[model samples]
Target: MAGSRTKGSDTLRAAQMYYLQDLTMDAIARELRVSRSTVSRLLSTARETGLVQVQIRSPMDSAPELERAIRAKYRVDVHVVPVADSVNEVEVMERVCLQAARTIGPLVDSNAIIGVAWGATISAVSRHLTRKITHGSVIVQLNGAGNTQTTGITYASEIMRRFGNAYGARVEQFPVPAFFDQAETKKLMWRERSVLRILGLQERMTMAIFGVGSVDADVPSHVYSGGYLDEVDIDSLAASAVVGDVATVFFRADGSDAGIVLNERSSGPELALLRGVRRRICVVSGESKLNGLRGALAAGLATDLILDEATARSLVESDGAAEDAVGGFLPLDTASGR
Candidate 1:
């Protein structure tokens, strides 16, 4: 009797291993000295007795339909960060920033020129970059880091210092304003030999990292908070139906630079210029930034996007989010209403 009971218990344990631990049925049968059929029966019993339960976890489980819609619509690399129900906008942005930093840190290479835009979101990303120094690299501020209220160079300098410290590379600071008072002023400044030298370096950038700024972003936009834009500029942006900006170049909800005057005075590269770079990474957060994020995608300003899950889901579900424009999955059907 003892021998028979021991054999049955061993069979049950084998079934537990096979079903619960995902061990092959054949392997379990061989180990337990039982027929395959017997192993199958034992597994069935284990399941029926609630000893085994299988579950699959998907990143898109929170919004499956949204993920499918974004994938089908944009067809670019999109990372939808997951957000907890109780999280605030600041927390969301932090999560997205950290994720972006983690993603870009490993992609950095020796002797590479990394073009970076100035903003709170990018600042957050810089704080999270913890990679060890492995290459001779250079961090170049893409746009003039100064603004009307203060020299934005300090913020950019701090960010570059951190990056250089991590990789033991040199840092280049662009000491110009985010936008000049007039287009002519910008045109004349571009002619300066020193300015031209930095501009030349931008053309050879290996990777460009930026952040999208929404006029009504749930979290305070860096442009607004950093004093880059004054009341007049903000009013002008609003009057022009500007939705968002990448590096101070404003775009409409459909990603068109239709009526925004600031784009001409902006220090960063134009949309076309940014497209020439190999990698363009845009980091964004906040549900209110959905339209802005969509605008960036429509303008071909971003090759890779890092966003909070809630914002990503919202972007995916809204047909207006991924308008067709500038080739790629999102086509530019300007005739259609946004």
Candidate 2:
């Protein structure tokens, strides 16, 4: 019994130095005063005998209950960012973005194709991405940015550029209009060979990152306030009972996004197409996005969500969430002008 216990202690020390301290096999052998072959056997035996343990724990600050509740309520993965009660709303948003980047960075791989949609929340998250060297990965724009008032390229391009730079991925831009005046014009343009190439890349996307565009979010969705929509557009959306949009494709409170007249002219991919993506990460900030987030979830748009704790609690604790099994439709006040 004494000899067996001494062997176990030796195994642990060898693992600590060889694995934990980044020591080479030869170096470990020298420190342990054993042959290199012996060190190899010990390391192998340590793992095989269950003497070396490895665990991946949740973040210390994670809200496991909120994560559990949101997962139970929505049936999707939830990452709740830790935002102190003292931090301002903007800082809260930035922290959410940081966590989102951290979550997404590991999922990227060499030669993977990712689709990205530009918006305030997504833009914020993109800028803080974890630097990586994922060669052959392509980041394709999911929607056009150009509007009548301004060329949308500068803003959206900057956002895409930041993502590309961080991941060392190639970028494919969509330089078409955000919304065409006539639906026929969009249909005609989409068939062009040059446009088809970008569309093809969009089709092959393995992962997509976007924000649920809310008309009432604390950080007002850029597409709504970015001169992409006119008074008539706003009026039409409201009259049609539209709640919010994802990638400029508007959906209702009940998650119906198809056959809407405004959708025909929008350049964003339809919700049906987005549903097919393997990993769809939706990063949201303020509680004012409750309706929009609910709408996206109703359509089965997001596979992962990262947001602040207050918003997560509000979502999981809202009224009628259990009955419908759709979303948390609580009323929240969101300030603007960031």
Off by over 4 Å in 2: 1-62, 319-338
Instruction: Quote the positional error of residue 142 for candidate 1 in Å.
Output: 1.2
Instruction: Give the best candidate by TM-score.
Output: 2
Residue lDDT tens for model 2, 75-173: 689888767778877888898987788778767888988999999999999877756667799999999999999889999999999889988999999
- Candidate 1 residues 1-338, lDDT tens each? 32365644764687667656788889877777778888888776544333343334586476445556666665556666777758988888888887777677656778888888878899898888764454667888888868767887677889878777766778888889888989999999999999998898888888899998887877877787777888888888888888888877888877788557888899978777787888888898888888788778777777777787778766755665324442334344442122
* Candidate 1 worst ten-residue window by lDDT: 329-338
List TM-score per model, in order: 0.76, 0.79
